[model samples]
Target: MTWKDKLGLVHIYTGNGKGKTTAAFGLAVRMLGSGGKVAIVQFMKAPKAYGEQKKIEECGALIESFGLPKFVHGKPTEEDIEAAKRALARAKELASSGEWDLVIVDEVCVALGFNMLDVGEVRELIKSKAPHTELVLTGRYCPEELFELADYVTEMREIKHPYQRGVIARRGVEY
Candidate 1:
């Protein structure tokens, strides 16, 4: 009944463009629709800020987000660092528990880029995941070394974005 043997693979969605989280959530939807379990640990994003959080949960996926209301820029504050660490710990536990078919660590690369998280910890989390768990990592500035460790590494290079025209993030599109 368990598809554990077939589910162990690492996916990385990174780069400056959009759709990294979208891709991850898309996979989450597929998994859940197919009677698979999923868990998402979001780093550097507040739980209530995103529209997907509520809807994804309604679709039977567990989501936990860690971050302050304010976005971290340049150097992160202690609160940001602590939140990232908490998210990291939860990600490790869920990824290794073998309870979910899909495990996503969202925005973790941003945490790494901002120095809120160390690549070593993320490296270890990937290494320690359950054998049957499918892992997804999302965000910009993903460490090149991690790409080498992934089974599917997708870089969403910005071809064009509405941000260039000064359009801000809109609900249901960019969230």
Candidate 2:
């Protein structure tokens, strides 16, 4: 369905790529340009030194980082799971009330892949979101259930990345 035709749409941007969260942010910008309210919940990223968080504030969107720096790769701690649950609950609250037109859960797939958040719970949250709200899920290895629930799915395959080389993540480009 067209974006206009879908009041509540689920989008999955998954795979081993660099632009999953970037794609979600692009959609948030699009929705914001259309005068849609947006809220972003970052699951895997810590609040320490994220450049997008600053840019999002400049763009007039609410962003909440609900992650600790304790998790490593696909392994998460018990505290990380708790944080994910609380963050997902907060996102659901915002989505259910219809205050925002778009809600983005960034790196949620990684959280699920690491068993930090329940896939069933996330699916239910998306299914139960307000009709006027759109939800975007972004991260690598999105769950099959989430993929099935999505109205649109875009996978970004990494042919090559600068990280493969000795190139460090520079400011504004990598962060």
Give the whole-model CA lDDT for all candidates, comma-separated.
0.92, 0.84
Cα lDDT tens digits, model 2, 7-88, are 7878889999789888888888888888778999888777756888878868989999888865455567778888898889
Winning candidate number (lDDT): 1
lDDT by residue for model 1 over 1-175, one digit each (tens)? 5565699899999999889999999999999989999999999888889999999999999999987889888888888899999999999999999988999999999999998888999999999999899999999999999988899999999999989999998987977
Clashes of each: 0, 0
Considering every candidate listed, which one attains the maximal TM-score?
1
TM-score of decoy 2: 0.91
Clashing pairs in 1: none
Q: TM-scores of the models, in the given order?
A: 0.96, 0.91
Cα shift from native, residue 145, model 2 (Å) = 2.4
The RMSD of every model to the true structure, in order and in angstroms, is: 1.1, 2.4
